[model samples]
Target: DQQVKQNSPSLSVQEGRISILNCDYTNSMFDYFLWYKKYPAEGPTFLISISSIKDKNEDGRFTVFLNKSAKHLSLHIVPSQPGDSAVYFCAAALNTGFQKLVFGTGTRLLVSP
Candidate 1:
């Protein structure tokens, strides 16, 4: 089963507005959630993460929210930028001895100028 899912294939946002990306998960064993940003040809870069015990986590202009009850996750990029335009992926992992992540299909965000 696809444990993590991103329903939206793409989204467009103005350069200064907030961009909201959403994701969902089906696995209760996932204890950690992470967001990654990727350029066209580059690998996904780690953005932010939230523990299963925490509802939200933030870093600079990026914030991630998690709802364990609903098995949902979201990422908010405030004041979106043209440079912020990229493919965003949400991932979930169970931390036992090692971290193995199940990633959702990426959502392409176009932060237009």
Candidate 2:
């Protein structure tokens, strides 16, 4: 079963605008949520993350928010640039000693000039 899902396959936003990406999960055991950005051929790189204990986390232009009650999370990029265009993946993990993450299909973000 797909525990994590990104409902929107893709999103388009103009440069300098705010880009919002959403994710939903079916598992309640998840305690950590992470967002990863993958360039064309490179591996996914960690962006921003939010723990279930907190509602939001921000790193520069990136911010991640988790709504535990709704089993949902979202990534917001302020003043998104063309260079920020990439595939974003949402991952969730349980608080168990062994860290195992369940990832979403990914959403391709296209930032246009």
lDDT of 2: 0.95
Candidate 1 least-lDDT 10 residues? 93-102
- Tell me the tens digit of each residue's lDDT in model 1 across 52-92: 99999989999999999999999999989999999999999
TM-score of each: 0.97, 0.98
TM-score of candidate 2 relative to the true fold: 0.98
lDDT of each: 0.95, 0.95
lDDT (10s digit) by residue, model 2, range 20-106:
999999999999999999999899998888889999898999989888999999999998999999999999999997879999999
Alpha carbon lDDT at 68, candidate 1:
95
**Residue 48 lDDT in model 2?**
82
RMSD of each: 0.7, 0.6
